[model samples]
Target: MGSAREALLDAAYEAIVAGDWTGARMADLAARAGVSRQTLYNEFGNRDQLVAALVLREAERFRALTGQAAREAPGDVGDATAAAVTAALTAALDNPLIKATLTDDTSGLLPYLTTRSAAIMDVFREDSIAIFTERWPEPAEHPEVRAEVGWISETAFRLVISHLIVATEPVETTSRHIAEVVRRLMRDLTTT
Candidate 1:
């Protein structure tokens, strides 16, 4: 959050974008950030920690962007969910890190977005739960409803992630379909 820390993360991100994470050096990143190597180490502890920080930051950024989209979307829950997915896909297309990762299949950064995605998932899960709660307003006594919402949130997140990694359709079509699925799931929950 501090300027120095943010700068270091930016530098690290730029390095990863320019080439791959394996080629990124702590010293080079420090220089790019206009900070000493010691400063970078002090801020991030080590390379792995720095990498995690960078990945988590990007995940948080994605969540924030998509959350805003869902909030601003018109119509009902289905429409908002569609907007969120659309925003996510659009943002991914414009993200340099995502572009680089996709182009360089061997970047080894895919784990951050895939298998090792717990932190990223957690970020989205929290936001999704809040949004779901706001839209549905399940009472505290209705633990089953809350559990259903949590399941839906995770399902939606996995769907989004799947689309990000492997696009089979247009963004609009994919988002609309995802929204429909979400709406149907919510409808089922309400009806039962």
Candidate 2:
């Protein structure tokens, strides 16, 4: 993205972090970004799109970190999966936007964040698919194996998301358990 576009997104994110998305105006964002209102509109079209872009961008940042965790892990699949999932959960919990959207009962953005946030969802799903494929390329050659792993990755990611929002268990424990399940599933696919 151009500097102006990046600035606009950054300013919008700041507004969301402040829980002032409703109060945030094109003029405010433009001022924060050191751009004109026309420039902001030219980049994002409108506030809704700007918010969507912010969410997507933030989600992408988390996914990038998650992918890095996967890439940087040192041992086997279980260890690596644990690292990756833990990283994602940690980032989500730390991110102000995720915290605001998920934890704040009165957040006006909750409905849209939950129901219309396909871009955010895809960050986890697509990143998991890519990382799993990269780490276990042999499975991709088999259609059924690929499908099974995809399901496993999606389910594990959902568990991470749930743990982040609901917190039935400690994030570490839940992520570790999910990683074990994923490893077991992969072993079954290979052995049977």
Candidate 3:
């Protein structure tokens, strides 16, 4: 079996998906994970803590998937960025939690995933900064360049997420277009 912490979170996700956020009780969750209520509590204190862990775990899993997509694309920045974004947006459309976020407020936790996204933002910020610096290491040499790259990376990630939130077109088209935008931006940066 996996760690009790992961088992609890996995059960929690299943419960939330099968039912509602508020419906999953500590005892029920423990039963699903084959752990005691105290074990669940010890792993995650309370419902709020459990939810936070769930979201964080989901985010990290998404990030890993996204990184894999990016790596599989051609080494070029634009190609990788576009490919990663397309995969992420496509996956988000099918993701239960992310889909719940887009649909009204059924789960009672959409706001936590969307508007109240401090922890999520921090994850994206760090991931974006790392992606940028890795692709264009010259930025690492200068504080100003590093800041600018950081801004570009974070802004790009936000724009892609915003597109997901306000999805108007197909993932293929939007991600492709954004990739071009990124290419242009990075090209300009290299030229300057």
lDDT of candidate model 1 versus the reference: 0.84
Give the alpha carbon lDDT tens digit for every residue of 38-141 in model 2.
99999989988887888788777877888889879977667778998888787777788887787556546665454675566667876676677676676778
Off by over 4 Å in 2: 111-113, 134-138, 188-192
What does candidate 3's lDDT look like per residue over 1-192, in tens digits? 359988999888887777555666799999998999999888888988888888888878778888788777776667778888988898898898777556736566666656766676676666666766676666677766676765677667777878988988999888888878777776676667
After superposing candidate 3, which stretches have Cα over 4 Å from the reference?
184-192
* C-alpha root-mean-square deviation, candidate 2: 2.5
TM-score of each: 0.91, 0.84, 0.85
lDDT over C-alpha atoms for residue 29 of model 3: 90
The pairs that clash in candidate 3 are none
Of 1 and 2, the candidate ranking higher by TM-score: 1
Worst 10 residues of 1 by lDDT: 132-141
Candidate 1 lDDT over residue span 5-32, tens digit each = 9999999888888884677678988999
Q: Return model 3's CA RMSD, one decimal.
A: 2.5
Top-lDDT structure, candidate number? 1
**Would you list the rank order by TM-score, best first?**
1, 3, 2
Best-performing candidate as measured by TM-score: 1
